[model samples]
Target chain A: MIEVNYKHKLNNFLLDISFTMPDKGITVLFGPSGSGKTSVLNLMSGLGNDKNKKINSRFIINDRVIDDSINRIKIQPWFRNIAYVFQDHRLFPHMTTKQNILFGYNRCNSELRPEVLIEKFKIKELLEHYPEQLSGGQKQRVSMVRALLSQPELLILDEPLASLDYTSRQELLPYIECIHKELDIPIIYVSHDIKEVLRLADYILIMDKGKIVDQGDIADLCISQPLLTQQEGASFILEARVTKIIEEDKLVQLDCGETILITAESMRLNDKIRVLIHARDVSLCLSPPQDSSILNCVPICVDEIQADENGKLRVIAKIGKQTIVSLISHRSARQLNIKKGKQMYAQFKATAMIK
Target chain B: MIELSPILVTLKLATITTLILLLIGTPLAWWLSNTSSKSKVVIESIVALPLVLPPTVLGFYLLLALSPDGFIGHFWLYISNTPLSFSFSGLVIGSVLYSMPFVVQPLQASFEMVGKPLQQAANTLGANSFDTFKNIVLPLSKRGFLVAITLGFAHTVGEFGVVLMIGGNIPEVTQVLSIIIYDHVEVLEYTQAHYYSIGLLVFSFIVLFVTYSFNRKLMVRL
Candidate 1:
């Protein structure tokens, strides 16, 4: 676990935040601007050194005390074994891409092979070129390779995609996924984009006005704080395993609570996936609808019903042991008499967000 | 006939002064660019004093300091047992002080332009401050070094009042191009003065032209 508690006085606000992150997954720091997200990363990486700013903090990573105000033990950033990929991709302008990637590798005497990262990031052809010659997506890819070649215990990415256009961002997302899937190093990714957060985060820390408002596993946080996701629709994720594939119809069978059909492509049987079901896409019925053309209509028990600010009722129900939410109109809830402990059938079509 | 000794002496003095300024000015400029202490302003003003103050006024104080009984002269005499007044060594000391700002300002501006982002990036990438400065900051400041060297050399070559007040026009030792030109005009030998004046003019123009052209090429790659 990586634990941190930090307090700093900014010009307009005081930033006081504390949290512990899992050791080996992407824990995203999500917030709007001026939320002190970058400051947290700086403090952990030991780059928050300014003469006027007095930061009182304690940061420990896996039993190693990186910073402790009480003990007066603050390691320099170079010695902290942390790699940071900044928003601007601050590549050395004087060095070619090859030398830039090898900078940290040569400095730390790292045992990781540079060629492995070079090939993984697909920067072989761009090695001889300088940073100015590469495109934005290509530069970010090189920056990631540069960070990974150091073999850091933790990696920090500060909105590495914020500067890129839509096409570049789409191109770079899979490379970021590879960082977590192919490599075991823990990563602290900072982003305000909801789509990036939902796709990349295994855990989430929500910040507002320099404070951590809430944090938990991504699935729980999405339901608990819908506003934090900032996505247009309320969505909940379901962890399921693919049981079969009907190739003729381009549909995959997932076993979440029961056999469910989702429109997905290139999915193999036995592959685990997370299906994002938007609350608006689901509807309720007193009995299973026959010949309705809805692919999924699973029996569920209403656990609770809560009124939302939009004059709609968010019906929380259990399909077997798994939780699903449906946002339905209040008039419909009154007409159907949906209440706590009510038994009904929830129907929806699953959209595969990630395979 | 034109004596070549003054030209040679002037070249030698300018060469040595430029070399020494680079060695000392680089670190001083680096510190000035990066430091936030209040004392930085005081040091910066002192380095810049030569830019505004008349050269004769600066030469007069340097003349006092280089005399046998003056503080710096006494220290120098203690080490080498030679009075610094009117010596080639004294002229060198005078020229260094006169040309300090020219060398340091360009370097400081260059260092500032490189900024803190790249250096922080280097630190996080496991490079210490010294390594980052050497590998990153130094190479990126190539244009600054070029400007500093060119301006420092040219300013030292054109120095007249400081060299005259300190070196006293001694032949083959302290005489320089500017002093020789002054002596020829004092004697109403306008033809002799023209030879040196036009040569200095062409040299200065050529140096500036080459530096700016070369800098433009370097900028494209950067």
Candidate 2:
């Protein structure tokens, strides 16, 4: 686990934050712009320390005290064994892509061969080319390879996809996923995009201004967060595993405490995935509708029903232990006679969420 | 035939002076470009003093400093068995000081252009300051080095007042092209003065033309 507690005076507010990120998955620092998310990453990398002001901070990564103000111990950035992938992909313009990727590998004396990374990132064809000649997605890929070849214990990705277009962002997401699955290195990813958080985050830390307002698993946080549900269209993630593929109907069967059907043909069996379901896309019924077009109709126990300020009834329910929310009208809740501890069925259009 | 001794002496002095300035001014320029210390302004002003000061003012001090009884001349005499006054080495010292800003300013600007982002990236990649400078910064600042060398050599070749004050008109040793031209004009040898003056002008034009053309090619690659 990586634990950090930092308190520094920014121009607008006192940036005070403390949290422990899981050591084996993607822990996303999520917030709006100007919310001090990038500042947290900078502090972890030991990049921007004000010489004039004494910054009080304590950072420990898996029992190593990387920084401790009380003891006056601070490791330099080079020796900290932490690698950073910046948003701008700060590649050396003078070096070829091959040389840029080998920069950290040579310095760290890493045993991880550069050929393995170059092949994995799929930059073999562009090795001889300079950074200026590569596309945005290609540059980001080279940067990731550079960071990984350093053999760092922790990798910090500070909005690595924020600058890319939609197509390039889609292209780079799988490479980031590969880093977590293939390498098993812990990553601290900072982003303001909720869609990215829903797709990539295992643990989420929500920040406002400069303080961490909440932190928990992304699935639980999305369902329980009032600030999240009150937004225009709130969504929650479900941890599900693909059980069977039905190619005739172009659908994949998922086991999320019940047999949930989604219209996705690209997934393979036994693959674990997170399904992002929006509240407005879900509707509750008194009984399981048999003749409807909706493919996913899972039986859930009603947990609670609360009235939002906008006169819409927010229904919270549970499928096994996982929480799911639905935004319906008060008349509909009254018509269905939904209440706490009552059994009900949550129906959602499979095509609305699946591609 | 035109006497080539003064031209040869002038070339030798400019070559040695450019080399010395590069050796000392490179580190100084690098430091001035990167330092945040409050005393940086003081050092910068000192390096820039020769630009605004009258050449005779600088020559007057060198005359006192390089005299046999003066501080530098006495120290030199004690160590090398030779007085600094009127020697070729004395002319070199004066030229180095006179042409310092020309060498240091371009270097400083180029170093600044290379900036901190690339250096920080190198540091994260485990390169220390010196290694980063050698591998990343020096190669990128090629244009700056070219401009500095060209300007330093040309300015040293053109120096007159400082050399006149300290050189004492020694033959083939302290008699550079500019000093020889001055002597020709004094003795009404108009034809001789014209030959040397025109030669210096053409030589300067060719050197500047080649450097600018080469610098343009370097910039395209950068």
Maximum-TM-score candidate: 1
Tens-digit lDDT track for model 1 on A157-188? 99999999999999998899889888999999
- Residue by residue across A1-355, what tens digits does model 2's lDDT show? 8999999888788889999999989999988789899888878878774567668899999999988999998888787888889899999999999899888888886879888888888999999999999999999999999999998889999999989999999899889988888887899999877777778888999888999999998888887766566666678778888899999998888888888988885787888877888888999998888899888899999998888868998899998888888889988988889899999999985431221
* Runs with alpha carbons beyond 4 Å of true place in candidate 2: A226-233, A285-293, A305-314, A328-343, A349-355, B68-81, B210-222
What are the runs in model 1 whose C-alpha is more than 4 Å off? A226-234, A283-294, A309-313, A347-349, A353-355, B214-222
Give the alpha-carbon lDDT of every model: 0.89, 0.87
Chain B fold agreement for model 1, TM-score: 0.95
RMSD of each: 3.0, 3.5
What C-alpha lDDT does candidate 2 achieve relative to the native structure? 0.87
Of candidate 1 chain B, the 10-residue stretch with the lowest lDDT total is B213-222
Q: Which 10 residues in a row give candidate 1 chain A its minimum summed lDDT?
A: A226-235
B205 Cα displacement, candidate 2 (Å): 2.7
Instruction: Output DockQ, candidate 2.
Output: 0.56
